[model samples]
Target chain A: MSRKLLETEGPKWVAQGIITAEQQQRLTALYPEEGRVVGLLPLLGSLLVGLSALSLIAANWQGLPELVRLLLLLGSMGGAYAAGEYFLRRGANDSLGIGLVGLGLILFGAGIVLTSQMYQLIGYDVTGLLAWAAAGAALTFLYQSRFLFALTVCIGGIVQGYSTGQLSGFSYFTAALTVGGLGWYWWRRPDAVLGGVLASGILWQAGLLISFLHAKITWFFIPAMLVYAAGDWQPDRPAGRALQAPPLVAAFLFTFGLALYGETDTYAGLLRPPLLAYLSALLAVLALSAAGKRARGRLGSLTDWLLLLPGFYLPSGLALAVATLVVLYAYSGAVLWRAQQEHNPDRITLGITLFILTTMAAYFKLTWAFMDKSLFFLCGGALLLGLSWYLRRAAARALPPKSE
Target chain B: MATPLPLARRHRLVLLAVAVQALFIIGVAAAGYATTAWGRTITLRTAPVDPRDLLYGDYVRLHYTISQLPRRLWRETNREARPNEPVYVVLQPAHGAYEALGVYASKPAIEPRQAVLRGWITNSWRHGLRIRYGLERYYVPEGEGRKLEKRPVLLVKVSIAPWGQARITAVNALAK
Candidate 1:
């Protein structure tokens, strides 16, 4: 489909009478060569010029008068925005324009910090930097650029971090703004890459909130699962799955850790919250997620929740460790079965990797003390190779024959 | 997907956003100026700093005398002082500098000679509590940080705005 492909393969098609030489020429003409290399020259030139200006300002920053410093901050920020707008209006170099806009957003944050430092001012609350996140969200909406959306997510994280780490208070307002402003944007747009970015950003904030409250880390899942439930409700399948990936990965890692360390009663004790309250909150989120899956006819993915089973509730012993392994095996097995049914090669690879990982964990936990070291290594390596070969063969057989 | 806004609308919105940002930055600068112009100034004494601690960067790390207080000075009787809890400290000018009179969970009424400053409890032990006033770091001009850091002790002048904002107006080495 690319010009390069046609340029290389067109002759063969013409020689075989699949198309005439003239037709091949027309087909090749349909895809024009991009001026990507030429475009880079100007981008590089501008970058060098910008760097020179930055270093110069940084060198003279201390000697500059207060008003001049303020003017410099404002002037550079305004220049970036104006140039962004001009490029956007020209309707060429869209990435360059958006990059400049992103720069402007960064400068706005720098402006806030520098201005405060200029007067040796200290704000007890997040009100000063909150404006930076607000501006990011507004620019994201106005531009409707994924780049801006991602930038805003990062700004939200930074603001929350500063609030909790420096001010010793969590800014609920900033958290809500990110979830509402960017969440609404993602809801309407439903892009795969943006969905992943949004979900991960929200998860990061959720983790911070958990740490801020000093709650038992188990409380993290309540908000994390809420994010997963939101993804289940998304109408776009791929985008929804992308949003769900982070929470699922987090859950999987937690469960895997539980498997590896569940033999210790102390660690398991730390994981247990007020059992009834935690279960009720988790159940409510589960019901919401189930309803969403059912509504979208994606009930098959309900098995993804297998990793969230509260196996730690079992008294820590051999029984607890064995139970966790069972859960891991069941979850990875489900992935393999689902991948095979859907004939998705990528998922098949993922499923195989997960299956092999669980096996290694199981082997290490069950056999390390009892088996001889050399024999253990030999058996483990052989088992993995054999499992991989068998899975790949099965996957090959499951796929429909290739047309080409 | 929702359609993007028209070019004219987009341009206007972007321009408006940029203008608002510029204004917000200026407003921050104004707040800084106003804090010094309209607020009450109080002088705080910094504890001696180990020379090695000053080697980090272009900012001098100041440990104020009021950063730590005796446990009995915590005025809350109903419950214990918790770490990271924001508390108001009443300071009365004693000797040559303001010293902590009491630490309260809520803002306590102060007499004409006393002032209340807010700080977060960083740590608490059997005998005392450590508090941070968000005025610990004094950013200095390039190469000047080292000069300031070499001083054994300093007197930091802070302007506390009526609205609860505070800032370091000046830091001077305490005369022996």
Candidate 2:
């Protein structure tokens, strides 16, 4: 709650015999005049500096002495961290310190890349990225830096993508880190637990998806479904009240996967259609069970289940895929109606968002003549804007007046 | 994020970590320099690869003549190299490029400067022995790699030390 709200309400509560003025004063004193919200400027400044450093190293036209490049890498990476630490010792400059540390990590990875570039090393594809992620993860665990948390997740995802597969053993390392890192985050900061879980989801899914992409397209659905199911295993606390990682990641996979199938029709695969379909159906049930667990007490009622629903009717025809979206639309409309009756603003927003996404996904299945394509997209976009405005009005009307 | 460390102690640890990380970054470069400075240098003709990765940015995905070995080059009792096993390509300077005289299941020692490039077999079957040289990547300056890759014209200078430690020295665009 805002300090202004508490102060304004305190005297009223005291007058109504809710509490004494002394109690009100005590309550107001609990929260500070200005809460410690992290400032964005320092982080942005450090990011720009990091980017310039990368660009300078990458654009090595001078063919400077190899030793000089090495020194540059070491100097920047070490210097940034040292400076960040110095600044960090001052209590007020915490954000600036964080930003500098972030730059140090970036330069650290860039140093590795630049070294590889200098000597022209090979087969070190995911090795450097994985190493960078490892360092970032370690720092994140120690310092509890959110920037490092995000950086580690990104680097780890890239590492997982570049590593050929589980057989390469790098993917296994990434998976292990995800589990380890998630545990560390949960223990250190209860508030950051959801973010940790989501990062883990990225680590878990990217390797699986890429490996499947390389091996067999049909097998990709299993991991996609599996991650979706895993998304529901949120902590049994208010902290897990954020966007669950597994399901959102699964949704991303579906978006890309469906877009691929919608664009390119490929019949070639390792497993036959019947078996793949059966496997998909089995995963759908598993995911539904997990989703049910999450729905025990969660917001965005219909949103979580949308990605899971379509997997059941897999190896879908373009027509079938388009048709199934009708079911999605009807489901969302039901949630919308129920939300309106119950005055649940969150559900109403989720319903509208899901409704639009289904419509957009349904668009790819469509085929328009070359001349009419532009017109079709223009009309579709205009329709979406109109729908968004309508939903806004509906939600605004359904909400109750704010109480002081 | 446990009980906050004493400020001075935390600063010391941060300094130590920063130093360690710096050493790591520089250590890789030192290793890179060591490989090139001490290793024997060899020139090999570039072969056509997928070319997508090489044609962009500071890193070039190089495919050398030794990377694609003929079945006859596999002088093993078995027709193909074992799957996921390291295969050494015994190199002899041919008329132009270094030719792979044989692919060994294990490291085969020879006279000094006689190159024996080591690589892992992807999947070796009859009539083929597919292997990847750790020498496949050749980094260049931004936008300069594509020009070096002009077809009918790409010679790469490679330096190799013991235990298959290798580095790309130069990728010269030799005119036919």
Candidate 3:
């Protein structure tokens, strides 16, 4: 049976030739047919690590002082390093690095939390801040993990820069320099790229949030565009399936940011400027999306419409604009249902699209709908329930019973 | 043009660096907490200071208790106030070194008869330190003092460092 299976796949493997005989041998040895259960270990390890992190965050039985808790967090980093070393000795791959880097992240988070808890702990020299920054950079280097390093550096930069009253786009630009430099250094490794993406997102959020707090309106739109650019830049690269999600997620976020700003502001408020600029900006995005060379069909269509949504703010267009989104979402759901029935397209992809559209419509109707929130919620719930039931049936029909 | 380091070596270095940084951050935090004996660090839920500013919208103008000072008294200490002037005060610690219990504004205060008498500010300084943030500001008009007489006053009692820098020793908040 093994021989037959190998014979069938061997030709394809040979034709592809991406995996050499030695690599194939290694794969087979690691996941021998009878003992393939061992491969589950990494998945199990990852789950445990994830759970521990959750537990650490969720624990409410508070006793330790903030400083003591921070010290314990530092100790946990030691444990992570030890775990990484053990994994290495046992010949594990980058997942070990990922886990260790996660520990570093937790520590960094703890540091930030502790500072806030300890009062406006200020007056640290640039050299002092850089010490922690260097440590964060070191974690990246140790794991060859650019993501954690980039994250550390970005947060450190924000803390340092913000404290000194010296934050700007130029600062963000400088931070991005690290992403390119370190990202390029780890070019062969996807983890590094992943790191860059995360770092960039954090920095973007930080800048936007700070700007929001300061009532600095101009920089508000930067994050939205940054997310859009991230999405636009992806799909061209050889990013893995996991990494592919972020760009699309970023795109959605960009649209949401625009919608949120637009819907929240009163028409006469000065804050409306950011919302207006965002609306115009979305027009350009819509045009680019229509240019159509990029990822086509549903994603592009949804994005284009999403960008156009801010036009809802126009008093004359408000009713029509909301109705359009609702209709589009309903149609997408119908299409997804049809796609599932035909077994010709990605059902989950269409379902997600339906979800986003539905959520957006609900948000607008609930917030912008004059004094009839209950009615809007009722309709939204009914639609969601109907879609869910339809999906269940479609899912049941598509997936057949498996034989052991 | 940097050569890509081997994954193993890179991983080791990154781990070490993160660990070290984490240690240093914790240390800094501990040090900050310890210094509370010099002055209290307080975060208030605040509202807008300018009544007209509130009329424009609902956001608040946040001010730190530490930043609050009798302007005339502060000016008098430095003689003439520059755009960025440094003022020092002595404090008593009620808790840790970082926590402030109360403060004595050492700068001279203006009096009708005394003219510019160098008087140490104490109870009045604590009253000024209670510059409210958040909903508290909303409830009180700009000219009005805190409505409740026994309101919680956040004070980090502190002493001056050798170089006349503020060093917190204790934090005392009036019980609700």
Best by DockQ: 1
Give lDDT tens digits, candidate 3, residues B28-109.
6655545555433422222214433332122122233434444433434434432212223322222322222222233433
Which CAPRI quality tier does the interface of model 1 achieve? Answer: medium
Task: Assess candidate 1 and give its lDDT.
Answer: 0.91
Q: Tens digit of lDDT per residue, candidate 3, span A152-179?
A: 6565555546433421223433344345
Worst 10 residues of 2 chain A by lDDT: A263-272
Candidate 1: Cα lDDT at A61 = 88
Instruction: Give one digit per residue, the lDDT tens place, for model 2 in A1-404.
Output: 77788889888999999999998888888887763446566767878997897687556633667778778778878888878877887767887788889988988888887677676765433556667878878777667766677677676666676565422434667766765674456435645455545545553555465554455444544554444444445444334433344444455455435543633335424323465565567567565646656576544443545544443244546654554566556656776877888788887897788667666666645544343778888977887899899988988988897787
Superior candidate under TM-score, 1 versus 3: 1
Tell me the deviation in Å of residue A215 in model 2.
4.5
TM-scores for every candidate against the unseen true structure: 0.96, 0.66, 0.48
lDDT of 2 at B53: 47
Flag the better candidate by lDDT, 2 or 3.
Answer: 2
Better of 1 and 2 by TM-score: 1
Consecutive 10-residue window with the lowest summed lDDT within model 1 chain A = A261-270
Looking at candidate 1 chain B, the ten consecutive residues that score lowest on lDDT are B51-60
Clashes of 2: 0
Interface Cα RMSD per model, in Å? 1.3, 3.4, 9.2
Assess each model's interface with DockQ, reporting 2 decimals per model.
Answer: 0.74, 0.36, 0.14
* Angstrom error at residue A203, model 1: 1.0
